[model samples]
Target chain A: MWTSRRRTRAALVVAALSLTALTAACGGADTAKTAAGAAGGKGGGAVLKIKDPGNSGPLAVAKKEGILEKRLAEVGATVQWGGSYASFTATVDAVRSGSINVLEGAISPVLGYLVSGKDIKIFAFTDPVTDPAAPQTDGLVVKPDSPITSVKDLVGKQVAVNKGGRGEYLLLLALQEAGIPADQVKRVYLNPDQGASAFATGKVDAWWAIVRAYPEAVAKGARVVVHGRDLKDQDLNMQAARTELLTEHPEVVRVYLKVLQELTAEAQKNPEKFQNVFLDQGPTAVSGPRLTDEIARTRYAKVPRFATAADGAFVTDVAGIFQKYGVLPTAVNPNDVIFDLKPAA
Target chain B: MTLEKVPLGVPASVKDPVEASVTSVKGPPKGLTKDLANDSANDSANDSANDSAQGFAKEDAPEREVRGGAGATALEPPRYLGGRRRGPVASTAVRVLVPLLLLAAWWYGTASGAISSEILAGPGAVVGALGELVATGQLGDYLLASAQRAGLGVLVGGGLGLLLGVVAGLSALGEELVDPTMQMKRAVPFLALVPLFISWFGVEETFKVVLIAVAAASPMYAYTYLGVRGVDRKIVEAARGFGLTGTRLAFGVIIPTALPNILMALRICLSVSLTGLIAAEQIGATEGIGYLVTLAQQYYRTDYMVLCIVIYAVLGLLIDLAIRGVERVAMPWRGQVAAR
Candidate 1:
C-alpha cells in the first residue's frame, strides 16, 4: 500500500512539473512575441494610447467625434483608447508604466509627478483657466450662515480639501495670499462627495471644491468664500506623455499634438457642435443647461510655441506651496521638467 | 488429546461407568479419568479468561496504531496540515520558499522587461525605497501612528466584544437583547459606515479610531460568543461539584476552556482593526501607513507604495504570530493532545 501511494505521488509530481514547464515555456514565448510585435508596430507607425478619464472632457468629446482616430488614420497610424482610470493618479501611473502613452490631467498633479521624479513631459495645454475674467472652476465654499466671510477667516478653522492634489495646492496658495499662516488652519482631506456632505452638515468649516459641485453646495446653503483664480492664474488641465515617448517619437508626438490643436480650434469655433458632440458622446449624463454652462466656461488653448516664463513660474510657485505643505520631499525647478512641444507655425 | 465422553447432566467428577470399564481394560488408574475431566474444566475456565484479555488488547490496539501513524506522518507532513513533530528548520524553510519564489519571479520579470517598473516596481527598488523611508523616519512614524490607532481600536473594541459576548453566552436574556442587534450590525459592511461615522464623530482622529473599533468588534463578539457557548456542560457541572459558582464558575470552568476561541477572535479582530485603520486613514488622514501609500500612489511611486504594503503585511503577520505564541502558552494541553 505504501509503495503504491508513493508511486502515485511521484507520478503526480512529475506530471505537475512537466505541465508547469510546458506552460512557462509557452507563456514566455508568447509574451516575448507580443512585446516584439508591440515594439515593431510602434516603431513602424504611431499608436496613440490614451486613457479614458471617465469624464465629459475634450478627450471624451474627441473620442465621440472620432477626431483623434480620423487624424491618426490619415497618418496611417491607429489610436487605442485604454480602459478608464479611477483617478488622475491612476491615469498618471498607467502612463508612467507605458500602459498608456498619453494622459490628460490638471497641472497640479503633473507638477506633483515631475517633482517626485516621474519621467513625464507636458506636450500640450488644454482647458486653460488662464483667463482671469472667466468664472472660476474651483472655489472655497462655506455654509451661508457661517461667520467665515473671507479666506483669512479660515484661520483656526477646519478646512476640508480633496487633499494632496490640486484642491489642497490651491487652498494653500489662497490661504498664503490671504496673509494667513499655514499652521493656523487645520486641513482635512476628503473626497468630493464626503467634502460636500461635510460642508452641508457643518462638520467642516470650509470646503475646496470644483465648479461642478458648486450648484449642489449652493443648494445646501453653502456660499463661495474664495475662488482659486483669485490667488493666481491657473491652467485647468494639460496633456502629457512619457518623456521616453517624446524622445523616441517626436514626429508622431507632433502629429498628435497638431490634431489636438486643430480639435481645440474647431471646438472653439463651433461651440454648439462641440456641446452636441459631448452631449452625444460623453460618458456623463448631462442636462442641456449644465452642458451649456460647462461648454461656455471651458476655454481651450492651442499648443504652446514654447514653455513661457509664466508657465515655469506657475509650476515653481505650486511646487513651493507643495514643499511648504510637506507634500513634496524637496523643491524642484519647474523649468527643468516642463517640455515645450510646438506645432508648425 | 481426546477425553472419554461423559453422559449428559453428569458432573465431570462422575465419569460414565462404561468409560471407567474401558479405562480399566487400558490398565489405567480408576480415579485418573475423573482427575483428567476436572483438569479439562479448569482449562476451559482459563480459556474464557484468555478471551477477556484478547478483548482488552483489541480495544487498545487501534489507539496505539493511530499514535504510530501520526508519528510517521509527522516526519514529512503536507504544508497545509499544520500540527506536531515538524522540524523547525524544515517548517521555516517551507514557509519562506513560496515568498522567495514570488520575489524571484518579480525580480526576473522586471529585469527581463516583461513587467514594467512603472506599474509594479522591482523588489530591489522597493527595498531601496523602504530603506529611504526608514532613513527619513517616515516609515517609523507612519507605522507607529497606524499601530497606535489599531492598538487602541483593538483594546476598546475587543474589550467591549468580550464583555458582551460573555454576557450573551452566559445568559439567555442577554442573548435575546444583544445577539440580534449585533447580527444586524454585522450584516452591514463596516466601511459603509464611513459617511455616518464621519457625520457623527467628524473627520478627525476620533472618527478613524471609531471606524477601526467598530470594524474590529464584530469578529470578537462572534468568536467569543461561540467559544463561551461551546464550553462542555459536563465540565461546568464538574466545576460546580468542586464548589465553583457564579463568577468563579465562569472564570474557572468556562473562560479557560473558551480561551482558545477568544484568542482566535483576537487574531481576527487585530487584522480587521488594521484594515479599518487603512480605510479610515485614506479618508482624511495626513499621516499613517495608509496615507503614505496614498501619497506614493498619487505621485506614481510604485516603490513607495509597495513598501507601505509590505510594512502592513509584515505588521499583520507579526501581530498574528504574537497571538499564536500567547495561545500556545495559554493552551499547553492543546499542543500535547494534538501531538499525541
Candidate 2:
C-alpha cells in the first residue's frame, strides 16, 4: 500500500511539473507580447498608464466611471490603470522607468522629486487649493475639554500629524505664523486614524486633520484651531508625468489631462454624482453621504491650460518651506521641473 | 570486455594484515565500558561475587578507575576525537561573510543602476542617512523607545504565558479552561485585532504595549505548553520514585528538562514581539523606529527607510543571539551532545 501511494505521489508530481512547464512557456510568450505592446505605444496606439492610489478622489471616480478609458479611446489610445501605489515616490519611479505613464499627487512630492534630480514634469493641476471659496481641507484641531484654545496655547505641547507631508507642512506653517518657536511645540508623527484617536483620547494636545475628517472630529467634540487655507495660498494637488513621456507622447498626455479637467469640472458642478461614483468604485468603505459631504465641502481652482509662471512660483515657495523644515535637503527651482504643455500643437 | 580470472579463493594471508590493524585500533566501545563500570560500582559491596559472576579472569581483568564516586571508567580515546579542532574564528567568519556578500550585491546593484536607488536606496546612502540621524540624536531616541516597548512586552507577556502554559500542561482543568481560549486567539491575525485593541485600550503607549504583549503571548503559550507536556514519561517516573512531588518535582525535573525548548520559545516570542511593536508604533507613536520609517516613507526618503529596516533586522539578530546565549548557559548538556 505504501509503495502504491509513493508511486501515485510521484506520478502526481510529474503531472504537476508538466503543467507548470506548459504554463511557464505560455507566460513567457505573453510577457513578450506585453513588452512589444507597451513599446509600440510610444509612437502610436500607446497605452496610457496611470496609477490609482485607491483613494476616493476624482481620478478614482473617473477610473470607476470608465471616463478616462473612453476619452483615451477617442484619441486611438487605451488606458492601463495599475494597482494602488504605496507612495508618490513609487508612482514617480514607475513613470521614470516607463512602467507607468502618469501619476497624480500633491505638489510637495513633485518638488521633492525635482530636488532629487528626477526628470518629471507637472502636466496639470488636479485639485488646486488656490480658490478662496474652496472648503478648507487642512486644519489643526483640539479636543473640546482641552485647555489649548488656540495655536498660541499649543506652545510646549504635542501636536499630532503625519510628519514630513502636507500635515506637517500645515502645522509648521501655523506654528510659525503664531510666532511660536519651532522648538517649543513638539510635532508627533501619526497617520490620520491614529491622529484622530490620539486627539480624542488626549494623547496629543491637538491633531492636524484634513477637511473630510474635520466634521467627524467636530462631531466627536473636537474643534478646529487653525485652517491651512487661511494661512497660505497654495495648490495642493497636481498630475505629473515623465519628461520623456511628455516629449515623446504629448498626445497621450494631452488626452489624459483633458479627461482630468473634465472630471474636475464635473466634480465641482455635481459633487453628488461624483460621490456616487466614488462610493461604487472607490477602494475604501466610506459611505456615499459622507463622501458627498466631503465633495460638497471641497472647492477646486480653475484648471490652467498649462503650468504657468505663477504655478512655478508657488512650487518654489513650497520647496522653500520644505527646505527650511529639513524635509528637503536643499531648495529646488520649480521652473526646471514644470513642463508647459502646449496641447501637441 | 573479457572477464579476468577471480582470485577470491586465495585471500586468507592478505586478510591477516587488515585484521591485525582493525584489532589494534578497536577497543571496547565507550557505552560498554561505562555500563560495566556502573555495574561494578552497584555491586562494590560484593566485589568478589561481581568478578566471579562476570567470569573476569584474574590475569585479564581490566583496570578500574573511579572519578568523583560516579563510577565513570576511563576508556580508549574516542576514535573521532583526534582531528584538528573547529575554531570559533572560522565559524564567525562564515557567519559574517553571508551578510557582507549580500551588502556587496546591494551596493553593486545600485551602483550599476540595476536596482534603482529611487525604489530602494543603496547601502552607501543608507549609511549616510544613518550617520545623519545619529548625529541629530534621533536614531538613539527612536531605538531606545522601541527597545523599551519590546523588552517590557516580552517580559510581561512571556511570564504570563509561561505560568498559564505550565498550569495547562500539568492539570486537566487548566487545559480545559485556558487552552481553548488561547487556541482561538492564535487563530486571529494580529493586524485584524488592531482596531479592536485601539477601541479597548485607546491609541496610547498602553495600547501599543498591550498589542505587542498579546502577540508575544500566543507563541510563548504554545511552545511552553508543548515543552512541558513533552517531558519524558520515564524520567518523570524515575524522579517520582525519589519521592519528589508538587513544585519540587516541577522545578527539579520538568523545568530543567524543558529549558532548551523554553529558550527556543523565547527566541520566537521576542521576534513576534518586535513585529507587533513595530506595527503598533506605526499607528500613533510620537517617536520610535517605526515612526521614523513611516515619516521617511511619507517624505519619499528611501535611504532613511532602508536604514530603519536594517536597524530592525540588527535588533532582531541581537535579541535572537541573546536567547541563544541563555540556551547555552541553561542547557550545557545540549552542547556536549552536539559536540559528540
Candidate 3:
C-alpha cells in the first residue's frame, strides 16, 4: 500500500510539474502579445528597441548628447537602449527575432546570417577604415619584450582572435602574406575580454583584436606588432538592419543614417564629445594626447557613403574572407545582402 | 491444500518433491514402488556419497552449505527462487517504448513549428543531419578523436584517483594533508580554468586531455577515499586473522568489500571527465566532438548541433551501462542480499 501511495504521489507530482510547465509555456504567448503592443506605438509612445553591446564609442556619445533620440522623438519614436557583451551571436539573435530593428556593429555579420537563410540587410554604414596616417582601426599587438616584431615572427606562436570577425580573417591574410601557413601558427579564438587578459598576461604571444584596445596595449608596453595595412587590405565594419525592416520603414532608415552622418560631423568638429563618450563608457580620464590619438584612430569621423559599388566590393571581399576562413557557410555577394540608398543626394 | 501421502520418492528431498509427488499420483500401481526404490537409491548414491556421510547433519548447516549439499533441491537456492524474472519481451518493449515516446513528443512539439529552430532543432532535422554527417565521414572522425581523449583521460584520471584516494584513506596524515586542497580544487569551476589552461598549454591536445583528466580525478578521488574509509573494520580484522596484512589485506578484504562504492566513484568520474573534455574541446580544439558543435553553430547548422548533443547523451548512457555490467560481475554476493 505504501508503494502504491508512493506511485500515486509521484504521478500527482509529475502532473503538477507539467501544469506548471504549461503555465510557463503559456507565458511565452503572452510575451508575443506584449511584443505586438510594443510594436504598435504602445508603452506611452512609439518605442524603438536598440541593441548596443557596449556603452563605449559613438553610441555612447549619441546616448549622452541625446541628438538621435531627440530627432526620433520629434517623429513620435521613443528610443530604448539595451547592451550586451555576448558577441555577435546575441546581437544577431535579437535582430533576427525582431526584438531589435538595428544592430550597430559589424556589417560583415550579415553574410553569416544570410548563409543561415536570414533575409537581413545592411541599412547603414558606421565606422570607416580609411585614414592611413592615423592609427589602424584593427591591428595585431605583441608584448614589448617579445621577439614577434613583425607578422612573419608570429609563426608557431599563439595569436588570439575572434573566429568570424575581421580580426581573424585579416590575421589569416597577414600570415599568408608573411609566407606563413595558417597551420604554422596556433590561433587562439577568444572573446575581447579573454583575448585582452591573455595578451596582458603573456599567455598569448600576440592579440589580433579591435582597435579600441590598440592604444591601451601600447600604453601597457604591448607594441603595435602588426597593423591591418601591413597586410595590404581593407575591411569595413558597419551598422546594419534586417532588409524587411529597411523596406517597410525607408524614412526611418534614411533619417537614422542621416543622423549618424551628422553625429560623425559633430564628433569630428569637437573632439571633447568623442572623449566624453569614451570616458563615460571606459577607463576614465583619457589624457589630451591620448584622446587626440583615440580621436585620430576613430576613423569613422567620416561616415562612408554606404551605397556605392566600391563600398559593395569592400563588403563582398570581406564576406569572401569569412567563407575562406570557414566562419561563413558559403560566399555571398554583398549586393544580395545589401540595400543601396543614395544618401538623400 | 490437504496433506497428501508423502512421496516416498527420494525421501521428498531430492528431485523436486512436487514433481515426484505428481509423478507418483500419475504412475501405475505396479511401477510406483519400484520407481520410489530407484529414486531413493539414486539420491543416496549422489548425496550421501559426496556429503562426507554428513547428510543427516546438513539440516544444521549454514544456508550456503545447504545449497552446496545436493540435487534439484540445491539448485533452487533462496537466491535463485527470489525476484520475478522480467522476460526479454517486456524489457524490450519498455526500452523501445520509452525513447519512442520521447521522440514522438519532441517531434510533435517541434513540428507544431511554434518554437524557433535556432533555439531548439526539430527531431527530423537532427536525424537527417546525423545521417548526412555519417555519410560524409565527418562524424566518424570526430567520434574517434573524442573517444580516444575521453578514454585516455578516464584511465589516467581513474588510476591517479584510486592511488591517491587509497593512500589518503589509509593514513590520517595523508587525509589531513590532501583533503582541504582537494576540496578547494573541486570548488573551482572547471570552465574558469579553461582560459588559464589554454594559456599555459597553448591549446595543445595534451592540455585539453589533461584538463579533462584533472576534472575527472576529483570526484573519483573523493569517492575512492570515502569508499576505502567506509570498509568494515571487522572484515579487515577477519582477513588479518588469516595472516593477511597491509597490501594483501587491502586488496583481498577492504577493496572487495568497498568495491561498490569505488565503482560508483569511477562512474561519477567518467561523467565529470566527459563534461570537462567536451568543454575544453569546445573552447580550443579544431577537431573533437565539441569543436564540431561550435563549427556547426558558426555555420548555423542547427540540425548538426542537435546531432552532436544527442551523440554526447548516448555516449554518457553507454558509459553508465558499461559501469553497471562491471558492478554485476564484481559483486556476486549481491544476489544473496537481493534474495532477502
Candidate 4:
C-alpha cells in the first residue's frame, strides 16, 4: 500500500517531470518559430535577438548605452541582447539554429561554415585596415632571445598557429612574402592558450598570436615577425545576418548598423575609456603604458558600412587562400554568400 | 612513567601479593605506561579503545609513594593504537604555510623579473583584480548564476539517476531495460554532445542546463546503481521478513546501507558538473564565472583569467568540504577517523 508521504514524493517527481517536458516542448517551438522570421514579442513587434558583445569593441559600447534598442524602436523593432559567444565560429552554428540572427566578428574563421551550405549572408563589413602603422589585431611572435628574426628565418622551425584561423593565414602570407615554401615551415596547430604555453616553454619556436595575444606578447617581450598589417587585405571585420531576418525585416538590419556606427564614433572620441571598457572589472595582460602607446599608434578604427557587392572580391581572394591552405573542405561560390544590404546608386 | 621498565601479561596467580601490586589492579593496572600499552601486537583498527586507555593514561602522578606501584608484576592487558594528534594551531599553520610559500615564490619570481606579468599576473595584482570584481558585484552575480546551474543540474540529474539506480538494483527486469542503454550513453563523452544538443535544443538556457544535467547524471546513475546492487541481501531479506514491501523494503533497508556510495556519487556529480558548466556557458552565456573567463580570454585579461582559475579552485575546495559535512551528518554510525 502506498503511504501518504510516498504519494507526496511521487507527486513532486511527476510535477518536476511535467514541468521539464513542457519547457523542452516550448523551447523546441521557439527555435522553429524564430528561425523562420524575426522573433515577434508578445506585443507583436519585431525582436532582434542578438548577442551583444560585452566588455570590449563597438558592440560592447552599443550594448552598454542601449543604442540599438533606442534606434531600432523608431522602426517598431526592439533589440534583445543575448550574451556573447566565446567562439566566433560557434555563433555561426547558433545563427543556423535560429538561436541568434545576427553575428559580428572577424570573418576569416566563419568561411568554412558559409562554404558548407549555411544560409547566412554577409550584409555589412568594416573596410580593410590599409595603414601599416595601425595596431595589428594579431601577429606572429618569437622569444626575445631567440635566433629567428624574420619570416625567412622561421623556415623549418615549429611555429604554433591556430589551424584554419587568422594566425595560420597571417603566417601563410608572411611565408609567401618571404619567398619560402609553406611546407618548409613546420606549423604546430594549437589553440591560443596552448599556443601561449608552447611558445613560453620553448615547445614551439614561434607562436602566431591573435586579437588579445598580439598586444600581450608585445608586453611579454615577444618580438613580432609579422602581423596582419604586413599581409594583404584579409583583415576585414564583418557583420552577418541570417537571410530570413534580412528578408522579413530589413529595417532592423539598417537601424542596427546605423546605431552601431554612431555609437562607435562616439566611443572613439574617448578612446582611453573605450579601450579600458573592462576597467578594474578584470585584469588586462598589457600594462597601462603599453596600452596607451598602442592606443596612440592605432591609426584606424573600422566603422562598419553596409557592404556593396565590390566587398565580395576580397572575400573571393580569401576563400582562394583558405582553399590553398586546405582550411575549407571544398570551394564555395563567394557570390552566393555575399548579400548586398546597401542600395546601389 | 617508564613503560619499558614494566612487564606485561604476567598472571596475578604467579606472583606474591606484596611483589605484584598491579596484579589485582582494575583499570590501568598499576605499572602500565603509554609506550608499553601501545605495542605492535596491540595496534587496533578501532580507535575507541585507544581513546579510553588514553583517558585513563592522563591521570596525575600519585602523591602517595609507590610501595607497590613500580613493583607491580604486570601491566594493564588493554592494547592501544596510539598516534599523537597535531594541535589545531599546528594543523592550521601547516595549511596556511603552503599557499604562503607559493605566494612568496610567485612574488619573488615576478618582483625579480623572472616571471613576466603577461604569462601570469602577480598575486598582488590578482588580489586587486579580485577586489575589483567584488566591488563591481560581478563575482556575486557570476557565482550565484554558476551555483544555480550546478545545483539545479545536480538535483534534476541526481534525482533521475537515483530513481533509475533503485529500479535497476531492485528488479532484474529494470536492469535489463535500463542498464544497457545507460551504459551505452556513458561511453559517449558529454563534451562531444554540445554541438548535437545545440542543434536539438538550440543554444538557450535549456541547452546549457540539460548539458550539465546529462553530465551530472551519468556518474550518479553508475554509482547509485553499484551502491544498490552492493547492498546486503541479508538485510533486504530481514526487512521483507518484517512485512516491509516495495518502496518500504528498498528505502528502509537497502538505501540506508547504500547511502555511503550514493553520497560519493553526489560528490562526483557536483565536481564534474563544473566541467559541463564550462562547455555550456561558452556558447551564449551572458552571466557566470565562465563568462568572466570568456571575456578575459577575448579581451586578453590575464589577471581576470587567473582570478577565474582561483575561483574554480576555491569552488572545488568548498564542494569537497560540503560533501564531507554531508557525510558526517548522514553517516553518524560510521567511526570518525582522521583520513590519511
Candidate 5:
C-alpha cells in the first residue's frame, strides 16, 4: 500500500513540474498585447521618454488628448510615462541614470540631486506661486484644534514632510523665517501617502501637504494654518534635465520643451477641457472640476516660463541651501551641475 | 587484444607497482622528453624566488613551536555533530555563501556600472546601510521582535495542532468529525485571514502573533494527522496483545513510534510560523524585518532592504539548524552523519 502511494506521489510531482513549465510558456501573451497596443501609432521613430513624478492633472490631459505624444511624434519622437510614490526620488534616480531626459516634478529633490553632485538642472518651472495665487499646493497644514497656529509654534513639534523635495525646502524656509533652527523641529520624514496617515492620527503635529492631500486634509477637518506665500522668495516646482542628456541630445531637449509650451498653451486657454488628460494619467484619481480648480489654483501658465539663466541661478541658490542644511555635501558647485539651456544659453 | 584478456587478474595494486617499475627501467619516456624541454620554464620561478629571499629567512626564524589547538576546545567537539554533517554543512554554506557572493557581485556590478545603480544596489551602499542600521540599533530590535513573534506562533499553534491532529487521527468518529473541517482549513490561505484576524484582534502585537499561529496551524495539523494515522498497524497489534488498549494503546504505541513524524510536524510548523510573521509584518507591523524592508524601500534606501533580507535569511538558517538539533535530541539512536 505504501509503495503504491509513493509511486502515485512521484507521478503527481512530475505532473506538477510539467504544469509549471506550461504556465511559463503562456506568460509572454501580456507582453505581446502591450506591443500590439504600441503599433496603433506610426508618427515617429524617435521616442521621447517623459516622466512625471507627481500625480499632476496636466499629465492626464496630455495623455487623454494624445497631444504630448502627437507633438513629440511630429518632431520624430515618442513619449513614455513613469510614476512614483516618492516622485522626487524617482525623478532624481531617473535623471541621474539618464533614463529620463526631462523631469516634471517638485524642486527640492532637484536641489538635493544637484547638491549630491548629480548633473541635473532645472530647465523650466512647472508650478510657482505669484501675487494673485498666494496660496498654492505648497503649504504647512495642521490638524483642527491644534495649538500650532503659526510656524513659530512648530518649535520642538513633530512635522511630517516628504524628504528631499520642495516640501522639505519650503518647510526649511518657513522655519528659517520663524527664527527656529532646523534641528529644533523634529521632521518626521514620510511619503505623501504616509504623511496623510500620520497627520490624520495626530502622529504628526503638522505636514507639508501638497495637492490632493492638501484638499483631502481640508475635507478631513485639517486646516492650512500656514501657506508657502508666508515664506518669501521660494522656487516652487521645476522641469529639470540631466546636463549630459541635454547637451548631447539638444534637438530632443528642444522638442521636449516645445511640447511643454504647447501643453502650457492648451492648459492656459481650456484648463477645464484638458482636465481629463492628467486625471487619467496621474497617480491619484481626481475629478475634472477638482483638477481644473487645482490647476487654476496654481496659475501654472506663468510658472512654466521660458527656461532662463535666472532659473539656473535659482537652482544654484537651492543647491547652496541643500549644502547649508547638510542634506548635501558643501563643496558642490551648482553651475557645473545645471544643464545649460541651449536657447537660454 | 587487451580487452579480450582472459580472467587472469591479480591484485591491481601489485600490477600498478610492477608496471611503474618497468616504466622507470625504460630510462624515461616521451612524457619525460616533454618535461626535459620545459625544465627551464619551471626553473625560472624557483630561481627568482631563491634569489629574492636568499639571505632573508635563516636569521631569526622564530623557533615558535606552532601552538596546535591553541585554546581551541572550551566546548567539547562532538564525535559527529548533527549540524556539521555533509547535507547540513553544504546547505548552510550554499545558503550563506551564495547570498554573500551575490551581494558582492551586486555591489561590484552597480558601482562599476555593469548593472545600473538605479535598478540594483552597489555593495558599499548596502554595507553603509547595514552600518547605519547597526549604529541606530534598528536591525537588532527588528530581528528580536520577529524572532519572538515567530517562536510564540510555533509554540501555541504547534501545541494546539498536535492535540487536534492526534485526537482526530486516533478514532474513526474523531476522524469523521475533523476530516471535513481539516480539508476546508487547509484550503484557506493564511493572508486572507489577516483582515478577519485584525478585526477580532486589532493591529496590535497579539494580532500579529495570532495571525502567525493561525497560519502555522493548518500545516501542523496535516503533518501530525498524517503521521498518527500512518503509523504502522503491526506496532498497534503488538500493543493490543500486551493488553494496552483505548487511549493508552494510541499514546503508548502509536505516538512513540510516530515520534519522527511529530518532530517533522514541529519543523514544518516552525517554518510556516516564520513565513506567517513576514506577511503579518508586511501589512501593518511597526517593527519586524518585513516592516524594516518596507521602511527602507519607502525612503529609497535599497541598502537597508538588502541588509534586512540578509538578516532574515540568516535567521531562517538558524531556525532550521535548531530544528535539526531538536530532532537529534528526540531521536538519540540516529547518530549524527559526518561532514562531506
Candidate 6:
C-alpha cells in the first residue's frame, strides 16, 4: 500500500513537470496552432486540414515525419490531415462536406465539383513528365500475348474502366484519337482494385489502370496498350483547394505548396528515401525498384506551381473529349475552375 | 472424424450437461433453434458446429482415444467421478502447429515461382516488415489507438444495448418503442452511413468513434435481447410464487439465470467492435491497425498488408481468451459441473 501511494506521487510529479514543459514549448512564438479567436492575430494564420494520399510518396513521408506540419508552423499556419482515401471521389466528397478544405487530385473530379456550383478551384497544376524512360502513371493493360495492341483494336472488346475517373478518361482519350466511337467497346465500370483482379482473371480483355494499378499490372507482365504519357497533353496532375479557404487565408495554401516544392526536390534527389519511408518506419511490401522508378515519373510532375494558360488548354481538351463522347452533358470552363494565384513565370 | 463406441467401460461423459452446454453456448437463440436443428445435429453439414461441439463429435465407427488426456484408467464398475484435464502442452502444440504448417506452404509457394511477389510476399518479407514496425514503435502505438477506440465504442454501445435489451425483454412497451428503431438500425449497413456521419461529426476522432459505436450497437442489442428473453418463464413464476416481486425477483432470479447469455453477448460485442474499428479507421485515422491497412493498400505493399492481417488475428485470439477467462471466473459452477 505504501509503495503504491509513493508510485502514484512520483507519477504525479513527473506528469506535472512534463505538462509544464509542454505548455512552455507549445506557447512559443512559432506555434501556428495558437488560435487567435479573441487574441486578435492577423488572417495569416489558420489550420489547413487536407486529405492524406496514403503511403507511397514524399507527401506520405511529410505526414510521417511532420515535415509539412513543421513548415506550416514556420509560416504561422497549422496543418491537419484527414484519412487517406482509395478513391478521389471520397476525397472530393470530404471537401464538399467540409470535412477537409484541400485535396491533391486529378482535374477530372474537381471539374465535376466546379460544374455542380461548388466554389472549388485548381490553384496548382503539374504538367505531366513525358520522358521516354518515364514510368507509366496510367495504362490500358492487356495480356502479354493478346492480339489487341492499340486503342483501335479495343472495338467490340470488354474493357474495364473506372466510371468517370482517370481510367475512363485515358481510354476515352485514346479511343477518340483512334477515331473509334466509345460505344464500340464495352465499358466495364469497375474500381482500380476490381479492375486489377478482372484484368488478371480473364474477366476483361483490357483494363484502363491508373496510379498504383498501372505499376502493379506492369509488374505482372500486363502489356501496355496506351500510356498516360502517350496521350500527349491530356494527363495534367493537379492540387485543388476550396476557394473559400483561398479567399480567407492564402498563407495556409502558400506554406503548403512551399513545403511540397521542397519535398518534391528532396524526393528527386533521394527518391528511395521518400518512396520507401513506409518500409523503414513501419511494415510494408513496397517493390523498391518499381517505387523508385515511379518516384522519377511523378517527382518532377509534383513540382508545385501556378498553372499557365496553356496548361488550362489540356483541361479544355479533356472536357472536349468527354463532351464529344457524350459522357458529360456539358464541358466545365477552365477559367471558372483555375484560380491563378500568381502570373505565368 | 467418427468416434468409437464406449468400449463397454467408458463413462457416458459425452452425455453430461456440462459438455453439452459448452457446445450450445454459442448456439442460435430459442426462436431460431427449430430452423437450425439440422445444422446442429451430429450428422449436420455444418463443419463449424461439428468442430465446436468437441465432446459431441460424430459418435460413429470410432478411432477415438480420450485425446490429450488419460482415459479409462479406472475402467471398472465405478468410472472416474470427475472429468480429466487435457495435457496443455500437447493441445497447445497441436494448435500452434497449424499456422507453422501454413507458413511452410507459403514459404514454398513463394520460393517457387508459383506465387509472385506481386501476389503475395514471402514469410521473410513479412517478418522483416514486422521488425520494422517494432523498430519504429509504430505497432504498439497503432495497437493502443485501435484498442482505445474499440474499447470506448463497445462500452458505450454495449451499455446502451444491455439497457434496451433488459427493458424490451421484460416489458411490452420497450419492445414497441426501442426494438423497432434498433431493428431498423440493424438493417442499415454501417458503410452507407459514412458520408452522413462525416457530415455530422467531421473527419476526426468523433466521426471515427461514432461510426464504431453505431456498428457495435446492433449485435450487442440482438445478443443481449435474446439472452434476457431466454430467461425461463417458469423461474420467474417460481420466484413470484415465493412472494419475490419486482426488482427483487429480477435481481434474484431472471438476471442470474440469464448470466451465461449476457457473458456471451459481451464476447460477441467485443468481436464486433473490431469490425467497426476497421470501417471507422478507414477515414481520418492517423494511427491504428486499420490505418496500417490503408497505407499498405495505398503503397501496394503485400508484406505490410499480410502483417496487418496477422495483427488483427492475434488481437482476435487475445479477445477470445480474455472472455474465456471472464467466463471461468463468473461461472464457477461451469467448472464444477464439467468436472463431473
Instruction: Report lDDT (CA) for all predictions.
Output: 0.65, 0.65, 0.63, 0.71, 0.60, 0.69
Model 4, B3-119: lDDT tens digits are 332233332232454433332223343333233334222222112233333444333123123434666655333343244668999988997898789879989998888998778
**Pairs clashing within candidate 3:** A121-A243
* lDDT string, candidate 6, B77-134, tens digits: 2122345766999889988899889988999999897997766788888998898888
Q: After superposition, how far is residue A131 of candidate 5 from its true place, in Å?
A: 2.0
Q: TM-score for model 5?
A: 0.46
lDDT, candidate 3, A1-345, per-residue tens: 543343234333433454465457447645875775566674454445565423235566777777678887766666666433134654565565555667666655456777775557765565455566766566798877889888888878999987677678778878767777778889898866467667766789899867555565666567777777666564665667667656766666666677777766776666566664533311123555666777665534567445555577767777776666677787777667677765557
Candidate 6 at residue A113, lDDT?
Answer: 67
Model 5: residues with Cα > 4 Å off, grouped in runs: A1-45, A52-56, A82-87, A91-99, A115-120, A133-135, A242-244, A278-292, A298-300, B1-340
Every candidate's DockQ is 0.02, 0.02, 0.02, 0.24, 0.02, 0.16
Which RMSD does model 5 reach against the true structure? 25.0
Complex DockQ, candidate 4: 0.24
Q: In model 4, what lDDT does residue B56 have?
A: 43
Q: Which residue pairs clash within candidate 5?
A: A46-A77, A47-A78, A48-A78, A57-A278, A60-A277, A60-A278, A61-A277, A61-A278, A108-A165, B107-B123
Candidate 1 local lDDT, A45-91, one digit each (tens):
76777764333545667788787878777776777765543345545
Best candidate according to TM-score: 4
**Which one wins by lDDT: 3 or 5?**
3
Ranking by lDDT: 4, 6, 1, 2, 3, 5
Q: Considering every candidate listed, which one attains the maximal lDDT?
A: 4
- Residue pairs that clash (backbone atoms under 3 angstroms), model 1: none
Stretches of candidate 4 exceeding 4 Å from the true structure: A1-40, A278-280, A284-287, A297-299, B1-120, B336-340
Per-residue C-alpha lDDT of model 5 across residues A74-129, encoded as one tens digit per residue: 56666765323234453444455444556665555665566555566666665454
Model 1: residues >4 Å from true position, as ranges? A1-43, A53-55, A74-77, A126-133, A219-221, A234-236, A275-283, A299-306, A343-345, B1-340
TM-score for chain B in model 5: 0.65
Per-residue C-alpha lDDT of model 1 across residues B37-119, encoded as one tens digit per residue: 34333322232223222333344344444656645543332222223567999989998999889888988999899976655
Quote the chain B TM-score of every prediction: 0.75, 0.75, 0.73, 0.73, 0.65, 0.73
Off by over 4 Å in 6: A1-44, A53-76, A262-274, A277-288, A308-312, A343-345, B1-117, B120-122, B238-252, B336-340
